[model samples]
Target: MNLKSAWSRRSFLSSLGVASGSLLTSATAKAEGMFGKKPKAETKRLVDGNPIVPITSGLGSTGDIYAELGVKPLINIVGTVTVIGGSVMKPEVMELIRRGNEHFVLIDELEVAAGKFIARLCKSPAGYTGLVTGGAAAAMVVGYAAMMTEDLEERIKLCPDVATFPRNEVIIQKAHRYAFDHQIRQTGAKLVEVVTREEMIAAINPKTVAIHFTNIQSDRGQVSGPETVAIAKAHGIYTFNDASADVPPVSRLWEYPAVGFDMVTFSGGKDIQGPQASGILIGKEELIHWALLNMSPQEDRIGRCCKVGKETIFGLLKALEIFVNQDYDETLRMYDARAKLISDAIAKFGVTARPREFNPNALGNVTPRYSWQIDPTKLKITGQDVMQGLADTKPVGIGSFGAGAGGMRGRDPEAEARMKAHPELAQQRRRGNGPGRDPNTFGFAVWQLKDGEDQIIADRLVEIFSAAPKA
Candidate 1:
């Protein structure tokens, strides 16, 4: 549209009342102004006197990828676990990765640059440094190799096959033994499990390389962090704490190591919201240096297969930057709001849903938790039925019943027998959600619900209850 043609159309529209008289007049003035016959209206500015423009938008959607693959993405009410692909990374983290894709840098050089930033972010002590690895498990391999040797050449060569090495034992509290202990053992180190501090002290023979602790299991173990670190320090052994899933009061990243542990590993993907495949291992500078020697980029080392790409490192770095400084109180309030929404939604139907405080053992989804006491008589549906319905729905919503309600009960001999036959049963038990232990009580996490997802969940629940009970 030329200005004259535009004005003629506007004038015709104005005569037919399709355009307002003022609009026609404004169009005529714009036409005259374009020809320099009239003064143009001053261009408007935003409050800050800057030109208003739409901010940049649109990265391609993963939904398309999943759709093309004939797979549906599940709603993550179960929290950030490896099976569910961990929590989604922050926009800042993604942006860092987006920009990272545009360039190429030597892996070793990039690690050095990224390491400094991560060290500062994790508040690593002046003598300590940090390295982003392939998730918390990979950190185990790196940390194990680091503690295995101070000699760079020996460190790289001895890993992935430490049969000839003298100090090949990594002491761990029997209670702290977890699925990821395999990551540590992968470096040809044997895990020596001890129950008591006395046992741990006694177990730390000349062959002991380091002591490992699982942060979530810390509360259960008799040996406190300080005690473990003290024993390790006294014995001249390195201590590595697997503080993987325990985050959200993100201060724990540096706090654990600051308390005297030689190394601490945290999942970059979980609460820290980095790349799902990356993690942070921050501790003593010397140990981190040795670990870097044993990591990827040096294809001959034990952790060579634990390759963390340039994008993942940068993503973890950015996530750490935002995580530490983020307004956690505001986040908690949002979580609280989501929890309340679900609790409130179910309350009207005689179901008792309450927002529960976050328990450290809840792992990845550590925001406010919501548990429901559904009276089967009132709703005419069992908690198990509700769980199954939600699970069967398109874009499945997974939730847990009362803690330990789902999964193999330790006390049940049959459950134990079943666990041995199906090793995955053990994983499901640890996941905190399996078969409901109670028919009347069930719960779900709220923090993992994306915007407007709570409504979908609530509607789904209402729909399930609305249908008549099966005879």
Candidate 2:
């Protein structure tokens, strides 16, 4: 409606005081979805003069000024990782975070209640856990304490010099100890590395706290998942699993706790869609309770450093909810289709662009990693050059910089099963040249792309590959 019509309606409502729920609902529905154009208010920004902009807003963020000027961001052909600001959270997560912003609640009580619900979801033994440090690395540290401290007072008295804390040793397979936030050491616990099952078993003693398991690291690790946990439990020690970015089965959240990984640390920013700084530590009820009691702001609280805000909590919860209710089988299929599109587009070049399914053994992304191979010799440009071109193109930023290193050569993974099925592809991939010899592989992740964005990017990639001169 124009100004006059809007004014007339406002005047009528003022006298009537008819603030009907139906009217609010209908108006919001229309404004949010049914309306032909999105509301300018969708883009909120902070005011320069004031820290919080409750009043005036500059025209810059509204996209209105930008639309008039013709500007937009490149499509993100990646998955939801913190570096990319995480996948634009699901709509519900944004709404929940907004609700949290508008309200207040007791932090202790909030954590307590949230823990109960989260634990139930994961079937964890802990009451619930919290991270103050803002990364899953902190989650591992705080979780390490949950099992070691033994009680509330001891939990409070954490971080004494090495001589002070009892059972200060944490055994990790020589290979499993990768670049985590060092949560285990955060407890001031010592790390003892063993190279074999014999070494691990021999390493476990009275001081042994727990065995750490890392799922994503590629190095040949001495400890296997089931074996690490089994060994720890048999010796009455705890098992902590680090499954960051390994969130495909979505069911894995609860699966870890159920399978007896005393504490499992997950990247909230990467997969669970929680705050980049927040990680979830769920397992053993007694341990979870201790972990919370040890969390930050409590006097001498060991975990006083790993705090999560109301917004992060709500957003994380929302992401998890989508993960829980999401049709995994269908989502996987969609990613499969996305990979196939690019693969099929250039398949005529005699290169195999196949969809890599999500299997635990695969080194690719948690979701299916669609990769396309190019005959490097036939495509005059190096894979890196093509990557640079795509990045420098009008719609740049397709995948990671690594994918540009000519297909398959730059750590792009092959599904273990697929590797077996396509033995020739593997041998060709390991030592193939461009086009005829080297099948240029492009691994595509679907989570990062907005709706229908894959088409534009995939098509653009096809064009670049088909057009570029072969090396």
Candidate 2: worst 10 consecutive residues by lDDT?
Answer: 46-55
Candidate 1 lDDT, tens digit per residue, 136-238? Answer: 8999888888777665586478676777677889999988888889888888899988999899999988889999888887878999999999999999998
lDDT of 2 by residue, 1-471 (tens): 011112355445643443354466557767777557663433232221211222224544442453435642445555765554555566677667766675667776776677666666655544434332356776776677666676658546746344566687888877776757366776778899888989999998888888888777634786677888788889998888787777766767776666777777777677566556666766666776677766764557677777777777777766666777778778767767766666666667655765464565443247555556557666665545555556666623565433333254445365777989978767655543334633245555666665676677767777777777656
lDDT of each: 0.76, 0.64
Model 1 weakest 10-residue run by lDDT: 44-53
Task: Give the clashing pairs for model 1.
Answer: 405-437, 407-435
